[model samples]
Target: MKKIILTIIYILTLSGCGLEQGSYLVGWWNGDIPTKLSDKEEKIWDICREKTKYLPKNTEEEKEKADMELNNCLHEKGFWD
Candidate 1:
């Protein structure tokens, strides 16, 4: 009975840890192309989206610039900020 209780506790702890890790990467869309983004900006958007976890969730938006200008024009004006 003691061993069963320990096993359950361990499973619960691991499940909680998994949930925390999953939550850290929320709001990241998994797609080859964001339909709202332009064709020329799709590549940069994908890169930025994958790296979203490393960026601020609010206030300070992560902007990806290409060719001396912001390439993600569509995404810049949307929910990112």
Candidate 2:
């Protein structure tokens, strides 16, 4: 039931497993949990967005590098790491 599902989410959230799990719980719960970004995360978000914008269009090499950079950024930020 709903209570059981919520209890499982609570346990996983506390265990600090990974962001995907945490994101789903918060997102699925419609922001039941706080999703505030820290100052550092805000800065990284800006950088990543800017970098994504400047990636060369119609260039395979540039696209690959951009993809790698984005992945690296996310990993560094501990999202998909």
Which TM-score value belongs to model 1?
Answer: 0.26
Best by TM-score: 2
Question: Local error of candidate 2 at 41, Å?
Answer: 9.6
Per-residue lDDT over 1-81 for candidate 1, one digit per residue giving the tens place of the 0 to 100 score: 999999999997886664532353332432333247565556655665565535443443333333213335436634243
Candidate 1, residue 69: lDDT = 34
Q: Write the per-residue lDDT of candidate 2 for residues 1-81, one digit (tens) a residue.
A: 999999999997887655565586747667666667877777777777686767775788888888888877766766532
- lDDT scores in order: 0.50, 0.74
- Give residue 61's error in model 1 in angstroms: 20
State model 2's lDDT: 0.74
Q: Candidate 1, 7: how far from true, in Å?
A: 0.4
What's every prediction's RMSD, in angstroms?
Answer: 9.5, 10.8
| Per-prediction backbone clash count | 0, 0
Give model 1 RMSD, 1 decimal: 9.5
What range of 10 consecutive residues in model 2 has the weakest lDDT sum?
Answer: 17-26
